[model samples]
Target: MIRFQHISLMRGTKTLLENADATLNPGEKIGLIGANGAGKSSLFGMLRGELHADQGEIDFPSRWRLAYVAQETPALDRAAIEYAIDGDVHLRHLQQQLAEAESAPATAANGSLIAELHGALADADAYTVRSRAEQLLTGLGFTLDQMQLPVASFSGGWRMRLNLAQALMCPSDLLLLDEPTNHLDLDAIIWLEDWLKRYAGTLIIISHDRDFLDGVVNVILQIDEQKLKRYSGNYSAFERQRAAQLTLAQSMLEKQTRQRAHLQSFIDRFKAKATKARQAQSRIKALAKMEELAPLRAAAEFSFEFRDPVSAPNPLMVLDDVDAGYRIEDSKGTIGKKIVSGINFSLQSGQRIGLLGVNGAGKSTFIKTIAGDLPPLSGKLHTGKGLVIGYFAQHQVEMLWHDESPLWHLVKIAPDTREQELRNFLGSFNFPGNMVTSPIAPFSGGEKARLALALIVWQRPNLLLLDEPTNHLDLETREALTMALAQFEGTLVLVSHDRHLLRATTDQFMIVADGKLQPFDGDLDDYRDWLFKTKLVAKSLNAEPSPPAVSERRNAPADTPVADNSNRREQKRFEAQDRQRISALKKPVETRIKRLEEQLAKRNARKDELDAQLAAPEIYDAANKETLKTLLTEQAYCAKEIEQLEHEWLEQQEALEKIS
Candidate 1:
């Protein structure tokens, strides 16, 4: 439905996409894969038409519906779940129209017309919307009461979920999500994966969540070395295919290198011979025509070197049955709102704990309380004797001065620390030379994040509290951080969405949920399995889940002179049971397939509407333009989804026919 023809996107001196070409078709779930700074997000921005390519063209059908969830979301006052979800002006307008149509008195002249309109509105699912809105909100990890709370009341991470809900709820054909799984916990991530898998609209996602990629996406589109490569199947399958291709490339390169070396050696030995000179010249020309071979080497290595612990166990932070929650200022603290309470947790030496929960589950609040940013509403928190701690907040990017250099900031914070020591420390975190003196203001979000990390490590605190530390980091940086923390030999507590990082860097898992923290015994894999198997909404929404029902066996005949005809009766009974089982299983598949078809139909209609909006001249209005852009993206996504579902429905139908 959308195609990029020799597209090249350059921002000043750097090329983000170099003559990249690809086609996105209906029913294909594409995963945008690359290392950090590989231009995945930039490419998505181009697709959203938020940024223009320096060269070439992006060709796609006009009037496509598109919805995008950006990396950062606007913070809003906590509002009711129902209010926020249905708050979109357009959706609300539809709701009002539907309501008016239903409330209008019907006379004999217009009774049938009004009745027909009412049915259409119902099918639109535009009115009586609170329940549906609540359902989606709850699916995304909000409690019924939590949904009604002002969005401004939520922390940045929770606010992200609200933003995600807006994107998901928006009527669109194509959905573009950038690192959508960041800041979310195992449960929320699993829930999102299922939601996308079952989603009937087209989806293009840039995520580091391996499990999500494996479950939700059917194809992998990799942008490596500024080139686009496509692979069929999910992440694991793509990895295998990529590995094979790389292996073949390596083998060919090696063989060519050996042949070239042998030829050069022969030429070198007889270069002075008059007769051999002509042959040598011919060999050189032949070699020049061959493509330069890439070296065969293992993927990049993640290594770390850190200062050893200087002291023994130093209890950093102490929580004494501390009930903690942020209280909003309500004129002299007379009236307040509590975010989390009854939180009792502590950090001790040599302890590595992974915090777990769904999005907006108070994981960040728990970390912040420990970090000493916001005081506890009730209960006591004590610091250990001579405790030195290092903290990395989820929004650490906000701490950097946009106008000041990293060196200036570091020197200002620690005047006593020598300049040489600071530079060396920063270098350890991969910031070297001009990078240390570069102004933080122009640094990308990821670079700023790394700067923050570098500054924190310089402190060399025995206690470390990290909240979503891996969120903005690329795979390579994340690996480095993981290694650094694993060898720290100090008390480390982390709240992160990267399962591989969590599993590799921490040993224990603690969940801050339902107003408390509980220890989970199993590992990341175990948590993932439990999430998929136990969460009902996640299960129902999973794209690759088994068919809705399993075939059941039928009842066997009971009477017929058992001794005389036992064998025949037994055979008949088995056959009957088998037939009944098949019938039972077929029923649910048909029902599910029908539901999928209905959703696909609605999405197609939405796509058509979005296409028209994109093609309209009225889109020049700023607000109308933004809305149109969103529509275009959603339309592309919807077209892709419709195709995927249709393929799945066809497969299911075939299975049903075979059994029948």
Candidate 2:
């Protein structure tokens, strides 16, 4: 258990936490969330013992081991697996001591030391350390070949994964992870979430990704108004609880304002008259000393609306046999590599399509092609006369001038705009007053992302092509953006790992996978199930086999008002075939179950007869002692056999249930 008692924390002149207290119990997975500058990292530092509370005590068991991902991983020549294994410093130390003891000169003392070291090694399970490290690496999306490669060989993101693997490899009572899913794709994020769910130790993760938090964390510690308040439940639950609190606070504030205004009116009407002067004076004094209620922090400052498009054209763009990819520089000449070929898509006005695929399955490429960021590698793409594209990618934030302010950026978009208009627009994005003039160099990733989004909305683009736009945004900003996109009267094509965003904004889904593109006639839940069955639609539509009967019904022909007769016929055929397959699989299992039941019944009957004989009073007599022992042994054997058969029957039943 960890306790923070009357904790007052400060960094320089800013107070991150003031007189806050929280109690974190063992084995609880907690999410530490706040705005960009709200000091989540500072709290983590205090927990790690690298920083101390200025005014209160943080008490925890000193013997408890702590583990956390290193912000940076050194470029080492050691194998990635070995680097991960190094996280278990205690196990490594024990192994080193054991090696030393074994290498020492042969003597009674040395032998004794070696024996003790071996026992310690066994206790630590030092022999399985390598396997455990490998498992962590694999769970973190490292391939077998990648695990054997040197730690220096991987890219920055992969190196971050290595750091995570190392942290997870370490044995600890408390584990701290900061934005562990930032560099992960949906697949890897799911894998890490499942692994963390099974972890027995306490986990404290700081992440802006709401879905990830909802999936893993059981508790939420929100940093609000310089106080760390613990909320029981996931992120969604926290939002509901917080919203209720804000509503109550707003009501209180309104009531206080009304009371103050009514009192002031009475004081003004009577203060100058002699008869009411004393009462008015007393009212004035009371008003002066009254504790005023602070105005509510308006539910969201990040809310901003995207400008409506000038002309909303149906079938905004059409890709006629287009191949989406990049042009590469070769020694001979420039060459084009088509990432997704044989693609056909049309974006109509008010159509919001969520793109689904694996991390490297040409999602970004397709989006880039649509945005005209990259030209089609092979075929032609026809655009409507009034088409306007608004592209927001993760890299767009990096393109912002570090020295220039948001005001300057917006001014470039609207050179003739008035200063007040510009200020109002920036204020919608929470960039008011000095923040509008402040250089973006000091801005956090979330701030930069918000600025980028503000710029996009300023352009009034009709078609939005956003690729991972919610990468660094906090929950409030994300919700604001989601709301903005939902209300935008524009066509949307988005590729993101955030399921909540996908579910909220997209009306339809288009899959970009296996060098091809096609419509996904399903909802977000179906997409998740498909992702589980098929590893991100690894094959082209025609190449892969047809879906199951249930899928066929859900995917009934879109061209027909009702299911066409032929479609119904096909669905019925598939259903029949499914039943046949299920029945074939069930027969043998049912036969085995019947046999187990028969054996159990016979054993139980024999045991009952033996029990009856053993219950006879003469069975306890010395003359019948042998009979009693035999009866007892037989009964024990019968009971054990029945239990074993029942276990087998259960296994068979579970298997059949899964099939059904």
Best by TM-score: 2
Model 2 TM-score (2 dp): 0.77
Cα lDDT of model 2 by residue, 89-165, tens digit: 88889878867866777565665566566556655756456756766775576766888999899888889988888
Score each candidate by Cα lDDT: 0.72, 0.81
Writing each residue's lDDT as its tens digit, candidate 1 over 405-464 gives: 888878987899889988877776666799889887877777788878877766767778
Candidate RMSDs in Å, in order, are 12.6, 9.9
Report the C-alpha displacement of residue 499, candidate 1, in angstroms: 2.0
- Model 2 per-residue lDDT at 373: 86
Lowest-sum lDDT 10-residue window in model 2: 536-545
Q: In terms of TM-score, how similar is model 1 to the real structure?
A: 0.70
